[model samples]
Target: MSHSPHNIRTASAEARGRGATAALLIAHCAGMLDLVALPVWVGAALIGSMGLAPAQAGLLVTLFLAGQVMASLVLAPRFGRWPAQRVIVGGFALATLAFASLFLVQTYVLMALLHALGGIGAGTALSCVHGLMGRSANPHRVFAMAGLALGLFGILVLGSGPVIVEKAGAATLFVLFALATFTAAVAALMWLGQSQSVAENQADSSAPTSTQLKAPIPKVVWMGMLGIGCMSLANAMLFSFVERIGMDRGYGLQTVTSILIGVGLFNLVPPVLAALLEKRLAAGRVLLAGPVCQLLLALAVTQVQSLWLFAFAAVVWVGVMIFTHTFLFGLIARLDTSGRALAATPAMLMIGSAIGPLLAGVLVDASGYQGLGLMVAMVAVLAFGCFLRLQWATDNRAAVVPRSSH
Candidate 1:
């Protein structure tokens, strides 16, 4: 049977959309391995195999996050100029090599360098993914899908990672990361080329040129980035130390591990809920609530001595971050039509994450767990303030929500 020309075009577009979604999901799952499995990679493995002090381990992780922030800042502005497919494929391939190298390295300095290099590669790929998602019909929906994928990935790694690390050794975790990234790169090669074609076909005359892309990002976008970054800072500051806090309060290892596992399991729900409520809830209003909720949770986790209370707060913490950040991501996507600012998503996130552990350590040393809670409160206020400023920008311009079919 012969198909109509319009039907053929529709079918082809659907096929391309499906392909792009698959590529984004796979690449996001792989690129976010470090973050989703942070407790395993940073807390457990580094202390166990590398024999580093908690501070050293934290610093090492910080170095890796610093690399991500640095690479994102460099690449995101030029994202429009570069070929997205090549950048993503090359980035993951580089990360594959770096993660593999990590399995062989033992010295702290060598390990730190390898971690940084791996972070750079992973960050580059992740930035491009954000850029692509921003350019899609519904950035919020696409990002929510990615978040759901990451949550599932988190469950698998968090549930199994400790056992694997215990049995096979810390270095095996690096091998797992290498395999994940290698798979992502191979998958991108198979699928992301189609996404590139779709992007090119969708490009408009107003699409930013090299010269325009090089121009400074606008103030509103920067504000959104900073707001998101502040939320990340508070989340990471407390999250990095949650297990330690529980143990210090006399919670058993078994209980702490169970909380982490619970966190992984519960992580699945928030993104699904966010996706469902995308149009029902206003992103701007939700953005304002995110920081406040983060502060309250941080305080609960740190100040609560009861095992149940602490566990509940700790488990919900990262999930809230995921849910709230999804809206912020979509909002920023709308604010930046060129997709360049959204491309810097990694930088905004990692800058805060990079500072979080170091700052938490200092605060903990200076005062106590309460000190960390105080820091979260301060950061939360900053985040709320930034989001508040964004209300005027969004309210004044109704065009922020583009007229496109989701």
Candidate 2:
């Protein structure tokens, strides 16, 4: 009996369903630890009594993003031939160490170095996760799964991290995150394998680029990228600076955690809705829903004063973020008709991710938190335009649902 790659059983409902389950679970579990670790760490770093300055504390955030960028850009392409699961597993183990480094290292400089290393691992793992989501047979389901997992995991981390931080101290709190990372590593080992063949599936499955080359870059993709960047920037701003926001607003640490957790809970909705949809929609629409939600949340940020109101807003913001990113990533994955799509997406996303926090950081420094929040809303306008264009561009391609976006 010969197994032909073209005639793989992955298309069967049973196989595809199982694949989606595994993909979703693995992503959700790992995402919980890695995603929450940074901001929690940021809070710890900025507030720590080591007399570290904001810029110095900011190094941890910078290193994390920089490491993620390096991993996604410099390493992901290199790991093209390696099984995604393998990369993910190794990445998790590295992340565990990275998390541990902060606890064990005394100096900020050393902690930054450790964070960079961890970022390498975390970035690679995340890239592989994104790659896997892209490689799925049911693109919508896969993307939705990623979104759901992200929301669920965000809930876990944000909801849990602060309590743990308060009870166990920062280092011990990280130990718990480390355990989560390790659990994800084990799950990946059990469920994910090298033969997952993400590279092959995406390369072959993505939409064609022949006409794309002849035509201009549709401005839609650029717009989409910008929109995502701004939305994420705002999200990052909240994640990085929410502690200060709370302090300024006379909120407690528990309230801060509640706010973050609220975002996670609200984020939990879109993936479910996205997954339940009967008709397969264009990736752009799928992606657009998230940012649109984010824009709404961003606008409502100033209006919410109570813990409950803030929590509701946070939940919505996070949900929007999960769905939007999951949608865009899936789009990028499926866009590899000409094979350059994967390489291009990482750079675009990384720029967006890094720029978001940096912009927020600058705004906070110059004008304060309210100014930064306004800046986020301003960026969302740009994102909306981009999402609109991308969706409009897809109106002509009725078959866009069945294939990639290149």
Deviation in Å, model 2, residue 9 alpha carbon? 11
RMSD of 2: 5.4
**Could you give candidate 2's per-residue lDDT for residues 1-406 as a string of tens digits?**
9877656744543454465357546645564343444456556534443445444555566676667777877654443455567777888899888877677777767887887787677667766665554545555566676566667777777778777766766677657667777877787776655555332334443333355434433334555556666666666665566655665677777677777777667667877776775256656666666666665666566545665655566556555666566666556544432223343334445455555555656666677767766777766677777777767765655455545533
Query: How do the residues 345-398 of candidate 1 rate in per-residue lDDT, one tens digit apiece?
Result: 899899998888778766876888997898898899999999888877777666
User: Which 10 consecutive residues of model 2 have the lowest summed lDDT?
Assistant: 336-345
Where does candidate 1 stray beyond 4 Å? 1-9, 194-216, 397-406
Which residue pairs of candidate 1 clash? none
The 0-to-1 C-alpha lDDT of every candidate, in the order given, reads 0.81, 0.61
Model 2 scores a C-alpha lDDT of: 0.61
**Highest lDDT, which number?**
1
lDDT of 1: 0.81
Each prediction's RMSD over C-alphas, in Å, is 3.1, 5.4
